[model samples]
Target: MNLPEFATTRTLNNCPAPAKLNLFLHVTGRRPDGYHLLQTVFQLVDFSDLLHFEVRADGQVRRTTEIPGVPQESDLIVRAARLLQNAIHDRTGAAAPGADIAIEKNLPMGGGLGGGSSDAATTLMALNHLWQGGLSREELMVLGLQLGADVPFFLFGRNAFAEGIGESLQKLDTPGLWFVIIQPGVTIPTALIFSSSELTRSTKPVKMTDFSIASKKLFGKNDLEPVAARQFPEVADAIKWLGKHGDARMTGSGACVFCGFTQEEQADEVLKLVPNRWKAWKAKAMQEHPLAGLLDR
Candidate 1:
């Protein structure tokens, strides 16, 4: 994969949009607007989806690839490109160039991995560079948030401790760990989990300092996990199976569960033992996104 040279590159190929694990999610409270206040660490992993981009002189953003069950208009990648195009035009009064975007998706939909959001973030970054939009990372982050709460974290380009419905981000250094993630063969709707009356929304918020101390032992927990596990037996069964090896927990909402290992060998050993019935893989924790350099600092 060639690194994108902002000034000269008309096409950015094999751009990576990595998946994330919510190290721990705590729903601290609910706003009057009905958005849940959340505290969680967004850990980027080596697992990712690849995207290809080619600049178009004609001002029309189009997704050339078809994703089953996802309409092109509704795809975050397309929406993100259009959003940036409109923003650029509105700011400069110049007809912004567009892009033909193709995605090589590896991440599962609704698996609690932030796949779609990450893809949207990658599109924003790639096109901003390709189009010379001159938007700062902070500016791009603002645009990303309009697509989804999780999008800004990817554009933020580092492993982050996130709050305020997962948008307010503070950088945090985490262990160089390996993770074995299991996909439970079902897609979990995040709204379903959040709307459940059984879900608890009153986990006391903890300070960054507390997490710094407790991270060594992987302290804190996902308050949404129990509700998801009870509603989706596949999630419950996966957590139960992986727990025998270590402390296994669901990542975001449901349908995927993970356990951390200090060593790659340990993660590999556990990965080999995962049940064939479940889809599982191992990945190393990433310090920053692969496309972090594309943004102007």
Candidate 2:
């Protein structure tokens, strides 16, 4: 990977934080610490949230944009920047720089699209480059895991087959299919779905080879979907409506349902027919993160 053209710039604008779809998620088991063991293929999509960062001379990390219901301190992007700033300071024995981050939110919160995680990963990568943090992609990934399990995958920069609470990843080539995503205007809490008594915690684990075969037919299912659908009727309605076109399924936990199409035209056709009540769009699969090249610096 080569360094991006913005390597020398102090301000990185319109930086993309792409969303991810769990093509298939299975709860294979549970860890003793209460974390669920998961098996899933994280497919990157063009749909994304944009972030802008300006280096701050005064050494104070700040978010210029305010997000409804999310406080500045609790925002993952802020946490990621501060974490990297501290790490760089510790490594170099000098004061690390700060940044002013502004987010252009596109992906819905609680929709299981991995928006927050992607934003945080983007912050770590962008600030690492702007501040000359000198952290390798692997080191950044290790730092990201402290924020969220899905955060490391955004930094991993490739579509992958994930296991072990979604941190253990192996590069996987997914089909270059287009997707029709439907957001049912409801937010489903992941914790609520996972904690449900009806949630399934045991699914037979399969190999990457198995996924290779199954990908051709879109043959896996999201185990948390049932729990989420039962708790939120809007999710079930969206799934039922989209299923008419193909094998529609909920990604990650809930609220958003999707169906794949081999052609962009086919995806657009379905996207048009989506109920006016729900938010719908189409995005082509991305083989790697747009900022994957930034790590080369």
Candidate 3:
């Protein structure tokens, strides 16, 4: 793939696309447009996907590899590059920004881990720097919002208490925790869960300041759990099994369920107990997004 270029041979590598967990997701209401209103805490995890970019001279933005079940044109990585490219040309009348982007996809698709959104956010940040796009961090975030709701939060660069369909956010200095996340070897479609009649759309929202490490038990429930659990028995089983270990919650609209541990060894121990039928990962919580420093620049 070639991108409109002004003659540079720079390559950006090892840019990280981290995953996120909704420590708790609450659906408080539904908009006339059919979007669900949400309140939740988003925590970054050490687990991540990596993306590498190489400048192209032909002015074509493309993904170097084809993703299964995802068309190249529709890949968030490709779309994000195009969006930034368009923004650049619109801003400077420069040729379309172009690059051949290769993503190391580590996060599970449809696991509700914000993998795609994080990947998109990283693309925006990486390309902005690669092309000297001059768009500020906040500007790229606004641009990311057009790609997906979770995109802005990833760009926000910190753990956040989010609301209003999750575009609104307030940073949180959440206590670190280790997690044993189990995927039921199934994918939970977000749209299906959101539209399910079983989904609870009325949970009293809480103040961000009201959240405390001491009171974690109070905010541990995800309003979408019932729907996902009902639709996927594996989710129910995973949740039930993990609950014996600690406070188990479904992160976002997921088939992936997780339990938190105060120690890495504790999480590792539980990871060993995860049934062979499911996929388990031991991850440590992060205070900020892996690309948090990029936002400051």
Candidate 4:
């Protein structure tokens, strides 16, 4: 397989595309364009899906597996690669050979872990190097944002404070703390959350420092939680269970619930106490994205 001079010299071939958790999500309003306005902090976690690339002669981007519920063509990874190719071709007068991208899915789908967006970000970043496009990281991030609001943050690839549909990003120096993530096995359609009449449409913006400290209270509930809990009782049950461990809160929209703690041991203690019926994991928050370490080299 052909690779960049730097990548060719390295032994490791795979890139780590990490997942994100919305430390807390607030639906502030809806735009006239039908997009939801949001304010939330995107926290990168050690948990991730592995993406392996093999350069191909043909310029066709494809995924190994159909992402369970998402259509192949509509998948973010494909769209992102196509977007990058278009952007680079338009600006640089050339395009890179498309690679067959394979993803080892570990993160749960529809759980709001940003798996799809992360995968898309990996596609753009990896191809930018693997194809030898020589695009600046900032330039790639700009192209990524057009793929999805979450895409830019994943491209930034770190702990970030985000607002305005989650495209706006501000990097933060959050310590590597531990988290307990619970998935209740129910898929809460994102559209349902946004379309719900009960969804909050107005929330005053809070300062970053003030927001970080206030997040400890978990007082500002996820606006979509109520509609989700009504549709899926198991989600509420998972939240109730994790709440016993710490200040349990829902991530984007619904379904997955998380609680942050100071130590892995404490998170493990809570993990053991959880009922065997629900799926859960204990992961440390990442100061930098797992993929950043790969790219930096």
- Per-model clash counts, in order, read 0, 0, 6, 1
In order, the Cα lDDT scores of the candidates are 0.92, 0.92, 0.84, 0.77
Candidate 4 lDDT score at position 170: 90
- The better candidate by TM-score, 1 or 4, is 1
- Candidate 1 colliding pairs: none
Question: For residues 225-258, could you state the per-residue lDDT of candidate 3 as single tens digits?
Answer: 9888888998999999999998998998997888
RMSD to native for every prediction?
A: 1.5, 2.0, 3.8, 3.3
Structural similarity to truth (TM-score) of each candidate: 0.97, 0.97, 0.94, 0.91
lDDT of 1 at 206: 93
Give candidate 1's total backbone clashes: 0
By summed lDDT, the worst window of 10 consecutive residues in model 3 runs over 1-10
Candidate 4 Cα deviation (angstroms), residue 200: 1.3
User: Which portions of model 2 show Cα errors greater than 4 Å?
Assistant: 1-8
Misplaced by over 4 Å in model 1 are 1-8
Candidate order by TM-score, decreasing, is 2, 1, 3, 4
lDDT computed for candidate 4? 0.77
The predicted structure with the larger TM-score, 3 or 4, is: 3
lDDT tens readout by residue for model 4, 65-176: 7567778799887888788788778877876577777777888878888877888888888877677666676787888878778888987877888888888889876656
Residue 195 miss distance in model 4 (angstroms): 0.9
